[model samples]
Target chain A: MDRLKSRHLQIAMFLLPALLFYAVLLVYPVLRTFFLSLHEWNGFAGSKVEYVAFDNFKLVFEDEIFWKSLKNVMVVMLLSIAIQIPAGLFLALLLNGKWKGIRFFKAAFFMPVIMSATSISLLWKFILYPGDGLVDGLLMKMGLEDSIRAWLADPSINLYTVILICCWQGLGVVMIIFLSGLVSIPDAIKEAALIDGANRRQRLWFVTLPLIREAVAINVILLVIGTLKIFDNIYVLTDGGPNHATDVLGTFLYKEAFRNNRFGMASAIAVVMFLLGFVLTLVANRAMRRESLDG
Target chain B: MTNAKVLRSSFMLVILAILITLTACGGNKGNNSSSSASSPAASSASSEAASEAPKEKVTLRIASAYTPDHTFGPAIAQIIDEFTKQHPEVTVEKEFLPVAELDKKLTADRAANNLPEIFIIFPGAGTADYVKEKKIIDLSEYLNADPDWKDGFISGALDNLKFEGFPGIYAAPIGAYSTGFYYNKELFQQAGVEPPKTWDDLLAVIGKLNAAKITPMAIGASESWRSEHLFTALFYKWNGAEKAKGILSRALPYSSPEVIEPLNKMVQLVEAGAFSKNYIANNYAAEIADFNNGKAAMRYSGSWTVGESTGPNSPAGFGDKVGFFPFPYFADKEEHKDSWMGGVSDSFAVSSRAEGHQKDMAIELVKTLTSTASSKLITEMAHDLTAVKADVDPAKSGKLIAEVSKAMSTGKEFSGDISAFEPYKPANTKLYDLTQAVLLKGITPEKAAKQLDDEVAKSK
Candidate 1:
């Protein structure tokens, strides 16, 4: 027993540095943020800090801009899942086989995942620039000027434009996830399915897809969390403007905290964002687990 | 294993833990100080404990929002270098961040109580918070120490830096900027129009420009400050500055017709197609490019454009063809005819966190930064106005800069930026959003005004 205690103490000594770093950097800030959410503070040294429990959350709830940002993020999350998954799967399947220049094609598909979001947003902004930008210029050249609209200016379609750009950026990672899943499938399983008289569609539905359910679960959960916290692209592209038609929770919280100096309100929004991502992820994990058990 | 071996290993582990804890503590102390030797306050205390050492080398850190290529950036750098040359014992560490990035960084630093020893205090609302919190020390005593430096500043230039109810001088002005319409003279002539002097004249010019197939104005609503500047010009032109202060004090509601009228005019401009096609999507760079490229007839911007429009940096090669005019006023409201939205918008302040010798060094840095010699460099090299009176020869400066300089001096009254709408910044943000929404026709002027009023009320 004494030897075991000494070994345990030695192990803890090894883990102490990491634990200290984690507690100071991560745990402390999170708890501090939670504490800040319950007070009214302008985030200034020696400034008045008033404790008004849940008032910040109440204010956030009553804010129309907050609701609008929430709705915009929801749209991005739903559309990212709808578009990125099937498209990523299709691309992954097409590129999965051993073919000529398959590596090059795979690299091309995954390039944007490694590129900076700010640069990508800037490139897209230049392309979608109104009147003289590439898209409008191309439309004019093709005599399709009638269909051209303010891509990043119009409140009606600005959010959708940003969402599409986000989808473009996020598609690479999803494709890579699905590609890895496809590669891990055994040759024997596919051969067995084929021998059992399974057609291409039948094999995909019965054998291939069932095997990649784990990747899909991961992709879904990641999309949910990633889309919910989306900021840089929207910030660089529209900055939650054209009258804030494109604000997400991240940008809204950031503006509240940094721009407005309302740390309390921003902290509350952050807490809500965390709780939301947590609940949705748990639900996705449970659903995936249930499906796997049923299969 | 023997017990002696286990005991020796345990002793080694204990020493390791001690080392880790010591390193962590040391790291924290290092981060809080400009140098590894000591924190600024701690050093100040120690130095006070001893007699002043004249030969001691000191490091002063300064944070500012000027890019190297910015109009003021080169001039500011040259001046700081000159100061360091004069006093070899002083070492200046300069941090340059873009304006938006600097604002956020300063906010975070303020919260952590880790602001730099010396930093630029943005004018008006930007200085108010620092003053209220006493994050920045009062500069009156420092200014009084040298009458020549105090007297060098242009009259009323320091007025805006002094916040109401806070008595002492908290900042010294460095740069003065004014907001107005910058027109392409060639385009206006091509369109058979003159520089607008009144509201009716502006409308007629817009009509003629539209008929000439020229975009009348280039507005970038994506940057809300562009629209906010326009709104400020309209409000101050119609109602003047006194009433603006009244509105801020809640003596007048934003929904009042005097305030809503500016929104109505903004909506009218939108309805009349006075701005470039899809102007809402354009950024400040793109908007200015439109005007400079002669694609648009006019733009509403600050005097900073004068430097860029004339110097080698001028992208469009328009040269002297760029002209300036104040925002047109209502023909009947002649009281505010001479008024312009203008003031010293950037200044220098020493952080209160710097103590003893460091505090004195920071004050000396501020004085050096705002001295007459520095102002001349800024005016000549940057072609921008300084708070200090500098003799700018017309031969060396462009016609545009000369005109702007004349307007800065001759204007009867000046008002603050759109940031002055409320002490609560979120309400000011809401005002910016509302102005953009009105420009985009997303919301009516009346509704936008009512919404702005409601936002301000909520902040209170």
Candidate 2:
């Protein structure tokens, strides 16, 4: 009993330092944000935190811009799940083979993943500048001048353009993850499928895909989290404007906290975002688990 | 063992560990402060505290958005460096952030109560909010005691730096900017249009430019300030000084025709293809590029761009092609024809948190930063009007500054930026966002007015 108690103390000693940092950094902030959300404070300390219970949440509920931002976030999430996952998987499959120049191709594909989102977004902004930008310039060169439109200016389609850019930037990370998962699957499984008279397509469909189901799930989760947390690129590209048409939850909260000086409303939005990410990830994990069990 | 026994033991151990860490750190703090072998800052502080020290040394941590490349930063730095040279005991540390990121950074700093003693202050809602929270120390007392300092400022220059609904100088201003239209003379000449003599004449010029297939005006609505500058120009032009002030003070409704009429004119400009195809995508830089590259005929920006347009920064002959025009009014009916929107571009202030030596050091920094020599450096190097008098030479400061100086001197009315409207920043943000929505959402002038009115009502 003395030895067991000593070991338990040793365990506590090992864990305490890390736990202290975690509690101070993460847990403290989460609790503080919840506390701040309940009061009307303009981000200044000790300066009149008017205790307007649930007023911030109520304000967000009535705000048209907030609803619009929520809708935009939903659209981005849907697009990432449906488009990014498949595109990444397809690229991963194509690049998994030991081709003569596969290394060069992989390097090219993963380059954007290493580049900063802000720099990439700014680069793309100039490339898509309406009259003289590369996109419009190429169209004019090909005598498709009629096809030229203000890609980033049209509010109806600007969100989709930014989403496409995001997918382009993020696809490499998903591809690299899927590639690792593909490589991890035993070669014997593919050989066995071939020996059983399965065609190449059939072998891929039956063996390669099922073996990397975990990769698909992980990629989807990452894509979802990234989509929800999307701010830097969209902010650089459009800043939730030509009038809040491209607004997402992150930028919306940013505007509230910094621009409007409404820290309470921003915290409320942040809490809502956390809840969203929690619920969605939980649902996704459950669905993936149940599906894997069935398969 | 039972789970309860294990949990209790672990909790006890955790508390024990925390106590040890705290006691250890607390002991280190005392040791670190008392010894001369720690951080440079601590050593300086120790030296300052010494009673027999002949001179004291201190450092001021400044947070500024004035990057070295920006027009103001180098001149300001030169001024400060000169001060440091004269007063060898003082040290300055500056952190430069771009203007876009500065506000959010400063907001975080404010919340943490860690704002530097002397930092750049933008005289708008940010300054007002800081003043309201009592975070900024009133400089009036200091200024009053020093008549040379108080009298050195340009006539009425410090007026807008005061807090709304009070009589206190909240900021010490550095440079002033004037807002007006900058037209490409070559394009205007190509389109056979002179500077518009009336509101109708301006519309005719837009039509002519559209017909010529040259983008008539460049606007960067993505940055909402461009739209507000448009609003300021048109509103003040259409309805002279009194009505404009009335609208700003909320004595007259924002939905009043005097305001809505100018908004309608903006919509007309948009419908006439007065702006480039992707004007909404272009930010200030892109807008400037389009105008400089001769793709756009006209651009609205502050007079500070005089340096960039004329200097080696831009292509040669760019300066000669550019000319300024105050926003046009109804020639036959308008009063206050010389009125225009202009204000102090940047200001500085001392923090309320400053204590003892820090307070004196902060005041001294502000005085040195805005002294006549610094003001002269600002005018000659930055090509913007100084808040204090500076002997600007025509050969050095160039023709654009000379022209702007003449225009400013003749102008009878000058108002602050759109930020001066609505004390609460969120209301100002709403106004900017609604202006964007109106232009992009296909909302009519009346509908836009209604939305703006609703926002103002909610703001109350």
Q: Stretches of candidate 1 above 4 Å error?
A: A1-5, A46-48, A126-149, A184-186, A196-198, A293-295, B1-52, B315-317, B407-410
Q: Go through the candidates in order and give each one's C-alpha lDDT.
A: 0.83, 0.79
Clashing pairs in 1: none
> B64-89 in candidate 1: lDDT tens per residue?
97678688888888888888998888
- i-RMS for every candidate (Å) is 5.9, 4.6
lDDT of candidate 1 at residue B280, scale 0 to 100: 74
Give the number of the best model, judged by lDDT.
Answer: 1
User: For residues B35-80, what per-residue lDDT tens digits would candidate 2 score against the true structure?
Assistant: 3123445533643565244546777777777787677777878877
C-alpha DockQ of every model: 0.45, 0.48
Please give the lDDT score at residue B99 for candidate 2: 78
Clash number by candidate, in order: 0, 0
Give all candidate RMSDs, comma-separated.
Answer: 4.2, 4.8
Chain A TM-score of model 2 versus the true structure?
Answer: 0.92
